[model samples]
Target: MRGQSYVILAIIFVIIVAIFAVINVDPVEVNYLFGTGEAPLILVILFSVLMGGIITAAVGLVKMIHLQREQKSLQAENKQLKETAGENQLIDDDNNQENPDGKKNL
Candidate 1:
């Protein structure tokens, strides 16, 4: 499972990089404040990609949290079932007559 995930992740990364490269848009430069210059095209594209990744991660995180809550609820229910079964077993045991001296009452 882990290997497959790694392979898939690599493929996705390759696809993204290839897409960016294929577009081949020229990098734009911008000046701000006091004589500071920046490349507009690359910066904007990179920031957009980063934001998209962050949004995707947040969605995944929410899903994981929901699944964890469900798992906890199931575990609690299972424990309750086990306890009830044990209690029933004890009641059944008490109904069976047994002599205190390691023998049956019959």
Candidate 2:
């Protein structure tokens, strides 16, 4: 099933991250604009990955919201067009009935 595939992929991802963390255990100095500190290399890598994922998700969310708004606007426009078409059809039917002789009114 699709759900099973996702579960398998998640397990594989966890194993990969675990292997990465175990292989990178050395402490290293981290520098920032205002301060500096020492942290395990694995922690720094994990933090960077987490921040990247957050940023990527934020960007995707913004795009999804924009698309949803556009979809709603399109749906409203479609509904309006359908209503106008229905009104025109009704008027044409009335005109045809009044002109059963099949001649122009003008």
Candidate 3:
């Protein structure tokens, strides 16, 4: 449901940008690091949107990779703890069996 809402919002945003871009079809001066150039307003708006999406996706990918690594580390630690607990339980059982008087060994 959350994903569906995001999709719907994205579609609506695209429609709005498309309408805005179409309304301003005049050429405009864009400043670049090296020099300045002239381009249609529609192309400029679309390019900016595309670049923003790319950067956002890249950041999301990095965060996902970090989370995956953290998850694996936690899983390994949990497995180690479980194995240690099992070993301790076995030792306790052995001690109980050896002491027929039902007295716990200090």
Give stretches of model 1 more than 4 Å off: 1-8, 11-39, 96-106
Rank candidates by TM-score, best first.
Answer: 3, 2, 1
Q: Candidate 2 residues 1-106, lDDT tens each?
A: 9999989997898789878987999999999899999999999988887898799999999999999999999999999999999999988887666455787543
Candidate 3 colliding pairs, count: 0
Residue-wise C-alpha lDDT for candidate 3, range 14-53, written one tens digit per residue: 9999999899899999999999999999999999998999
Best by lDDT: 3
Kindly report which residue pairs in candidate 3 clash with one another: none
Measured on C-alpha atoms, candidate 2 has an lDDT of 0.90
Model-by-model lDDT, in order?
0.80, 0.90, 0.94
Residues 27-78 of candidate 1 have per-residue lDDT tens digits of: 6665667786656465667676779879999999999999999999999999
Clashing pairs in 1: 28-40
- Output the lDDT of residue 31, model 2: 100
lDDT of 3: 0.94
Q: Candidate 1: worst 10 consecutive residues by lDDT? A: 36-45
How are the candidates ranked when ordered by lDDT, highest leading? 3, 2, 1
